[model samples]
Target: MQDTRATTTVAQSGHATEVHGWLKWLEVVLVTGLFLAAGFWLRPDDPLHVGNTFAWPVLAPLLIGLRYGFFPALMSSLLVLLVAGWHYDKAAATAYPWGWAAGMLACGLLAGEFRDYWERQLRRANAVNEYSLQRLEEFTRNFYLMKVSHDRLEQQLAGSSGSLREALRRLYGELSQTRSEGLNEESAALMLRVLARYGQLQTAAILAVEGNRNIQPKALATVGDYEAVSESDPLIRYAMQERTLVSVQTEFRKHLKKLDTDLLVVIPLISSTDDLVALCVVESIPFFSFQNRTLRLMAILAGHMADMLCQRDQTMAGSHEWQSLCSQARRAARDAEAFGLPSVLLKLQVNEQDLATLADRMTGLLRGLDVIAVNRANESPSVVLLMPLTDELGLAGYLHRLELDIRENAGRSLWDFASQQSLVVKTEAQVAEWLAREGGAID
Candidate 1:
């Protein structure tokens, strides 16, 4: 196909060149004929007539020079000289006849040189334009490749929620293994491993609450040769009493005597039944701020650990929650198909910074029946919306409206990061197929 196109282009260029050659010859012939015709009709009877058609010959060479170029113009000038000599007597022609020919030749040469200069300029401009066009095409190709890579990255990050869910499942699996091995020794080791992996902690201890409201601090795990502090430590006491997290600082140095650590964090593990099950004492570098998401994650892990310690069955609630949401969407899709109603599922990629605001706005904007799920993974947070009665066109309109609202209220930065992908799934089978194709599974 490329060869055919190249051949066709070459053929067209050759044809154009031939046409230009014909036009150049025709221009020369027409100017020469006009000169001859005018000279013959206006020839003076007096041999030495000052007003004889000498001027007509000048035009032929000048026109040829301007049109055909230097060599052709010079030849035309010689031809004019011959014709003028033939028409006039030798004596009359000899009188300043060479001067006239010289003038015509010089004029033609200058005009032809000017024409050549202009043609060279035009060719250079065309070359520049061609080079620019080639660069533009290359840039477009590179931009497309970059876009594809970016899309793949986004897709990978989009699966982060699933990845987190998988990690949680593995944690549960570890808990199951511990249970099978008789929970006393194995459970503490597994819990320490889980904590070290997720909470980024090194030196830590776990304290269990006894039935008599007394808490016993146990050195469950230690990463280094470190002394463990007692439950009576102020940090631990405060964390347990407040049922919240506490970090050791300069202000608590007096209270944390003998616990000479650069950093310390105490997290309370509260059970599902509102009972304080245990407290996690972590001594490490001061890494996390109070409001950091890592702290929140640590708290969540502590809760799960508390549940595990309380002998509660690990239900994989996070995974189950997502599964339930997908099931609801699937049911909604099936019902929509049965009732011949419209339904659209929209997947939105949002900037992590704008996620909270966007979620709040979405909740307010969407219909009551619309299901919105925000995957709160830090890598690439996203929101999924299942619009039960919205068709493709309706979805488009909704998107447009949302975009306008974002631009007006949220500004351009928010709008820039908010991108949506939509699918019209009318049946449960279609939804399942889409989920499978996209590597999405609730379980």
Candidate 2:
């Protein structure tokens, strides 16, 4: 139906153009006939003798050329030629006026060419203007969408609702109290409870993955009426294959019709080392809560859970310094990306003895939000300070104060003891690269 309507509209437009063109040609004929009539009436014996004075008949073709371009002008010039031929035949002249005919044709053709050139330029300018208008409309729509999204996010983050950082802090504190060697059954259940509250999930379960490939039939933790998910379920398979979050609204759009399982979303708990630890499957979620913002929030929570489990696993394996640094760096990176917050990593080369002496002093000099860690396992001992919510100016102020305090307390400057390097954390990959270059491993 739409195609037929579009065809009809185009046919109507073509008919209109044809009618308009015919009218223009008719005007050319009328104007040229009037010029010939007036010439004959003024001087019947020599109607074409105006060539010696002012060739007024040429004005008909020139005007038509200037108005309607080449074709109408050509028509008018042909009519004038016919009149000249008749006049010459009546006068019984032996030779026709070839020079006068050429002059009339030349005026029409030149004027028509000039008209055609400007018309082509006008069409091009119109096309460019139309394209620019379309682009402006698209940009305006996108800007409005972004503005609405920003306002919604601001409402979620404002007042007593508490920030995402606070919620994650509570999650970590709860999880830490339960286990020392990765997430146990109790801690996993606690994590699920927290997720259910924030995600507005009615039914969800955390299923353990054996060897990061096969999922266990029994769920380690569950919220609401949980059921076991089949290994062949498309959503499960896609989430396992992608090692990222999958939902009916996102990556599962293609297989949505063929989806065999009753799943709303699947959240993967992946360790910092890229190991698939487990899967958090949502059997049911609130209609309103199942949106892009909610999915992103769930992903962030899933990351923090993975970090906790991985931290415990690494601690059991006796890599505390690396795990601690990885957790802090990941948190800083996530905060920076989400909230446009800044964090600076200050690395100072120092011996183990100096670390023991200055760690307490540095902690006193820094703000409460700042984090300090000592790495004594490497051949050359060093200290890493993660200053959260700090930019370049804040780092300078802290450094100056630290130097002044160190000089007053020990009668020596900070540079005399240790050389330091600092970086503003933006992404986890950036921090990892900085660590590798500074003789430290992020993983």
Candidate 3:
């Protein structure tokens, strides 16, 4: 909304100028007409006192010019001259009252010019004031954003531990094990739980992004005492359009105030492919936790949830780069068992030097859906392939293909590697056992 104070002041100034214009004209007409009437009544033939004495009627234009600027003063001067000329003609005077007319015109013009100069200066000052006010409003808004951000940063550093990353990893693991039904309430509720643990969110709700256009209020899953998410909320609309986290601490406070509910922030759950999965509407949060780091953590958690939800086909696209191979393998194993899809884990040990070459060549031969992870810290580096939709038979065929390709391309066969092991993941238990066999090296 526009600033009400500035708008009202501008409106009042406009009204005052209009009223002053009308009053100026009224005063000039009344004063000049009164003076002329007096001149004609008190001194019939020598109205301007041309016979000898001061010309009183000249004061009309002189005073008007000093008060009302050029136009009114010039008009008053013309009226006086008209009366004087008429009187001179009526009296059959030999010489017209040129002296009196010159004095009146000169006074009016000089005073009008002075009034015009001051009016111009006044207008310039008003313009400067308006510009300054606009700049001040902008500065205040930006300063508020900066101050809030700074306070949040201080709080985060003071109260936070260094275990956020590990906590998020564990949270992701837990989330991955749970089956996501796209935008179902179970998934939304689980996601909110994770956010609450990290963000200290007191009241919040998750609304599914329906048809990629609108947020459907029907499938909302809420926590605490949050009211239903409104379709008309300004913060919601902005967050949906921008596809980002928007909070009261940012520049969207005006929109936040317009909300009928006490909405603190609106965070979009966007997937890896930039798909809008859901909207997380936060109603209440601790003041100490409302900061930039909290925002980033929220976004990260929300994004992880979005990716998991979007992975309805068990793609595991939400896996983080920093996550250990063991985590990815565990997730793959859980998905395999849950979805009744077979997956193969192939482990190959190679010389540290040939590990890069073999992995690069293997990547070209593997399907895009396959995941490859390398453990380079070991003296005998190993490459692990998490191949989904593949079982023992699929693994056998892949080995045959790899053997032929490596022999034909590199003049060496797969048997030249140190050793290899293949496991068909049937359950999460098998994954843990497999990692144990690796002595936690894959982790």
> What Cα-based lDDT does every candidate model obtain?
0.62, 0.76, 0.72
Candidate 3 C-alpha error for residue 393, in Å: 40
Model 2 residue 308 distance off true place after TM-score fit, in angstroms: 2.3
For each candidate, what TM-score against the reference?
Answer: 0.41, 0.54, 0.38
Model 2: residues with Cα > 4 Å off, grouped in runs = 1-161, 252-257, 315-319, 327-343, 350-354, 364-371, 377-381, 387-418, 426-430, 437-439
1-443 per-residue lDDT for model 3 (tens digits): 11112111112344433334456567889999998898779977666766657778878888877766676778899988988888778878888867778988888878877877766777788899999999999999999999999999888766552344454566666676765466676767788878887888888888888767777876467778877757778777778778788887664545444545468888888764467878889989888789887877687667657666765434322233213455556655655654455778888898988887889877878774466777654467788787766778989999889888888888987788748988898887887788666545222
* TM accuracy, model 3: 0.38
Best by TM-score: 2
Model 2: which ten-residue window has the lowest total lDDT?
Answer: 1-10
Which ranges in model 3 have alpha carbons more than 4 Å from their true place?
A: 1-162, 252-261, 314-443
Root-mean-square deviation of every model? 18.4, 12.5, 19.5
- For model 1, the superposed segments whose C-alpha errors exceed 4 Å read 1-163, 180-183, 211-213, 248-262, 285-291, 311-443
Q: List the residue pairs that clash in candidate 2.
A: none
Report how far off residue 172 is in candidate 3 (Å): 1.8
Q: How accurate is candidate 1 locally (lDDT)?
A: 0.62
Q: lDDT per residue, candidate 2, 1-443, as tens digits?
A: 01111111112322412235456556788998888888899878767654558788899999877766776678788889988998898889889989889999889878877776766776687699999999999999999999999999887666222546566667767777784466557877988988887788889998887688978878889989988779788888989988888897775566456767789899988766567778899999988788877777778778768877776555322246555765667667865775466889998887766776567778788654566777665577777788876899999998899888888887888888788889998987888787666555666
Full-model lDDT, candidate 2: 0.76
